[model samples]
Target: MPFFDHVGPEPDDYDTSPKQDVRLTQLGSASTKTSFTCGDAFGWANRTPGVPDLDSRVALDTSTDLASIPPFLWGLIASYGRHTMPAILHDVRCDASKAAAGNGGRARTAYLRRHADHQFRHTLKAHADQGVVTRYIMWCAVRLFGFRPLGVAVLAGIIVSMLHQSSNVFVSVSDLLNKVTIWPWLSWLDWVPQGIAWGLAQLATALRPNQPYTGIMIAVATISLVALVYRSFERPAAGGPVRFSLPALLSLVGAGVVGVLTAPPVLPLVVVTMVTRFVLWLLDFVMHWLDLAWTKVLRLIDGATPSNVTVPEGAMLPAAVPPFPGFFPTP
Candidate 1:
């Protein structure tokens, strides 16, 4: 039997169609939503063995972020995209499980959390137009952070480690800032953040059992590459976030998984990619600023009307201020 039994033909995979109107609205910055009732009932029952089933419908008032995807990850899998419908169904079912577990004690809560996460995975498989690799990765992320205090802490540490390692990118940004004559203090302070990040990584390592900094670093690199690979397959945006053709998305995601599992030496490659992007970004920033400054100089010269020309009667004159703003001073 199929894993999920829906009430009717499954809802559209995405809301990009003119005819499809998504009913959920974001509630502030958090990935959550205001409660709203559904016009038609959407139901799902698990037929897969060993997996818990909700055995209920989802027509009632629902509040969800559509997906629990973090903001930083929106570029890869947006909170609302092809998987929007499945996420909604999963959210509703997870809520039901949470309510049931409230009175069932800690063990029951843990059990239900697993059930909820598994159901989420199954729903994604059944409804989302996503590859198995993508769906499984998302499910694993959910499962990892579903364990409450410990899981949340670990995830948070991993994020900190990733940011810490990526701090080297900003060293070039600092140098460029110094050269642009913006803020000298910011230029030498790049090491401050790097130092702080190192300290935090140490703290996180101390808290973990095995102090897995190397593993965390490798994981971060792998995830970064996977995101890039998936992003490479993204289709141009029509009205919503960019999406992937099923075939290309599936292929990229599968390749990403295989690469991560088979090739453990990806840290250096990701490091190179990161450094190259940073340097390119710095160059672009410098060029844009130089272009803007040159344009401003030309505008001033153009507006000056040669000193040899007589001013028109009652014509407005230039303000008594520095001609180049921050780069110069008026006497």
Candidate 2:
């Protein structure tokens, strides 16, 4: 019985011939659907300006859902990722960071609340506490207002132009998706579902590049531009809903600045200008579209208000406004 050569009962099940218990360690990640980037407000460093370091920044995403979105559906939606995620993440990060720093779960919001003006904090809290779905829908409305989807004519033109096979490598959304690995910079576009239709017209002419739809998109775009311009000049009647926003003009101005900055020898200045105009046009389109939708919604709500509630003679009405009889509970 040469126990030295063969395995034997030596301290439990240990091999007499030096066995290695190799455990493959894996990087662990949280099972959370949420992560925050207080834009690393905490990690931003020392204030002693005599030897100050640069206030470095990172593109912050306080979104839980973006990280959780299925790989296939990331494009087209991620660009419009601002809903409730950022706010939620901000709150969570503040709380966690404070806790980690051994400050009794002193959430950043809480700390800020202590110092913030009461009105501001109250407003922040109100917005922060809004139901996720409602807030998300609100954000969707915002997205609809801001982002102009590539129209049919625009897409067709881009496609036909591509088949003509000019030097442009960027063709369709499919092309972008296929060549994704090569351009990892565009990887963040994974959640941008609209990126599927990003082949939009930069110039007005591109809107109706083909003879078949030449008049269609041009007419639509022109009408839309006219309506937007008209609304810009038109003042809201007294007590009427103010649909036209100043943000659109600001956006156009910002776009102009961006176009100027971005136009280089490689990318044409006309392309930049056209794209800017197109974006503003899109914004105008969306704002009106949303305004119409909002108008309808408001009409419904207003219609719900019980009219003709008879007031007795000499009966003083309550100081407070009466609640909508059908929708709101009477206090």
Candidate 3:
């Protein structure tokens, strides 16, 4: 393969080459129905030019399971397909980077992680089968959150909002206690800590003072904007669960200032996006559960043991059963 400066793999990358050895077998885990094990070696040689100068060889063997799609995004994307090669490649690279970091290459981990994201974005752009919007969203998600789990990303967004709410409550209670000369017992508790309370209180009072949802709006907007810049050009964080870097920190502060000034009008839009996400997640969960149940039902109707219905190599479990009962053609 020749190296190219352009984004994405070579155009011939879309073809299924026999040399890739890309067979997969679905595991029989009820809890992880979406998981699949590679039946043979799957490999990608990074020929995309201008990416980080990390190792170009990546591979997945029989022991490695393909990454499962996050439940929240399932409605927007399928868990498995030829179009998902970019994601699969990304997963292997991230795992390899984690392993490298685990073996005391801590200083270089952040750089490796960034390269993985870059590689994923470019490769995703090359897949003509996936829509432009879908690729963009996936790229943005990888860039924003890196290899962090969906729960961590969600919590990151919510924690700031919670801090804002807690700060307001703390200041309000302190004020209320100050006026209560009638209760000397309550006054004793007021000696807690005013500095921390007042600092948080400033967030609530500084902008959109009367609005309770201001924190959520600012938090979401600040994170979204800062993450865009952070992954795009900001210095990568030191490796660990917690991510922090001077450039990212500065970006966050700047985005926060902008968010506080501009997020009020977009508060309703933020609320709607959050609600819509929850609804989509719920629907995805229900649909997945139903798919698994229906698979079992079909096995029972066909007189085959559900336990024995293993997914063969290079195959996916069917997404659904026949919709109508008559499709079975009862004798």
Candidate 4:
């Protein structure tokens, strides 16, 4: 932050007295609604209250006072020469927000400055968000790599082995529970959740724990990559900006190549898992996206004025008076 020298109107700096504080407050509110930011120049008034400076100048017309601005601010003004000297100032923020949200999708800009500075900001922000997500996913995969998958496999395998041994005399877990009300052992098979667990263990070990935890990890990684690709095709919007990212693509390709190298024994299970997840997620996002259609419908119903859609170049935002009535001299 560059140091600013010009202090704003103090108690004795301008004719305004106690009302100087009140007027400053009003100017700040005006800045929020429009870009003619007079209040921003005198921000010290709010942060530090004292006598008004003897040599304070609050010029709302940024284009005219180029020489009076400090060196750093002058450099900024020089860099934006065209806008700095414009006869009227266009509010860049209002244009950007409306266009990106699709509310003013019909409006298109031909001006270079307006297009790059305002219209392009949203696209840049989206790309930044995608980068953060890609990093997070890769970080999680790396940190959880060695032991976590093995632990999950060991737990799953033990349950499978126990279920197989216990069902020897009985036909199923339900039958075992009925015949042997043997406290802890039988009680484990009593509930719906326990029954689901028994079913999963049976599937995982149908071929037996002769296959180790590494195999389970390979199968899971394969399934996840397959689901990601399927989901890419299944819901293009949901794939997001990350889908096209080089790092994201490379990480995915690497996972798939390793899965093929291992040739895990559970290809059938992996396919089923990937396909089921894609289908459910596809149905879900479709329902949510359907709601967004109404905004377009409402805009159409109300009827759009093509004239109101575009912001003209060198347009000054309306000069709203400070809210403190009678604070200024009558022209």
Off by over 4 Å in 4: 1-189, 207-244, 251-331
Q: What is the C-alpha local distance difference test score of each model?
A: 0.47, 0.31, 0.47, 0.31
Candidate 2 local lDDT, 1-331, one digit each (tens): 0001112342122123311121112233353132333222111112211221121111223222222221222232231233232333234333333343243222232232222122212322343344544333323222222222312222233344443333233334334443532235544434332343244323223533465355554664565455334323212232233344464434333432332333233233323333333344444555666765664565567654325344459954323322211211100
Candidate 2 global Cα RMSD: 24.8
Compose the digit string of candidate 3's lDDT tens values, residues 1-331. 2122212354323223323225666667444334565543333444432332334333334333343445333454555665445555677677766776654354345456666766665665654245655555455445444524322344345445554545555446444433432135444334322333365466546533436566566665665654544433322444434444555334334433433443344343333333344334444666778888887898899888987876669875755422211111000
Give Cα distance to truth, residue 34, candidate 2, Å: 13
Q: For each candidate, how many residue pairs have backbone atoms clashing (under 3 Å)?
A: 0, 13, 0, 3
lDDT of 2 at 8: 33
* TM-score per candidate, chains pooled: 0.44, 0.23, 0.44, 0.19
Query: By summed lDDT, which 10 consecutive residues of candidate 4 come out lowest?
Result: 322-331
Give me candidate 2's TM-score against the actual structure.
0.23
Candidate 1 TM-score versus the reference: 0.44
Task: Give candidate 3 regions above 4 Å deviation.
Answer: 1-21, 45-67, 103-107, 147-210, 216-331
